[model samples]
Target: MKLQLETIIIFVQNINRLKSFYVDLLKLNILEEIPSEWLLLQAGGCNIGLHKMGEHYPNKSEGDFKFDNNTKIVFETDQDIRSIRASLMNEKVPMKEVKTFDNYPYWLCDGEDPEGNVFQIKQRKV
Candidate 1:
């Protein structure tokens, strides 16, 4: 048996804000867009689905919806961590202070998506 992650969905108040942050600022490609309701973004090998809460599901109460910060999307690769960090900095992306653990390096950045989701970009030590 094999298990894999196909997509990460985030519910946001404003779809355009999230789209600009993810697609324009971060340079993520847009795979698909379902009008003003949902958008599918390409992130590495996985897909990120952003759904507009109030616009898509009007029947549901907006008060019932909440943003969850307990989970995070980690971008892992063999690319040089320092170089990647530098590029993001140059682009003026707001990132948390870089930290190292057991010689493994990682950095946390404020994704600035409409839902305020946190995105972590890291490189494991070889």
Candidate 2:
């Protein structure tokens, strides 16, 4: 028997805004959009789903929502760190200075979506 993770759901107040941030800004491919409710995005081999939350939801607020900066979605790759950093910089993506720890390179960036999720970009030595 084999089991694999298929998706990770991130809750949001607005689907359009989330879509724009994930699909347009981050350049993630959209797998499906379910009207005003949800959107499924392609993140490598796995999927990320954004669910729209109602005002009654416990976490919903009148203004913009804030996410825990400590929570990060890491995208791991063997791609060149310098090249990736250059490309992201050219696109004006807000990223932290690259740092090395335990012989690995990593950079952090805010996803800039409506929900304010953090993304950790990691480049493993090849």
- lDDT, each prediction: 0.62, 0.62
User: Which portions of model 1 miss their true places by more than 4 Å?
Assistant: 54-126
**Model 1 C-alpha lDDT per residue in residues 65-115, reported as the tens digit of each score:** 323433446565567666766776677654555567453344433333345
Model 2, 16: alpha-carbon shift in Å?
0.8
Quote the lDDT for 26 in model 2.
98
Q: Model 1: C-alpha RMSD to truth?
A: 13.7
Regions more than 4 Å wrong, model 2: 59-126
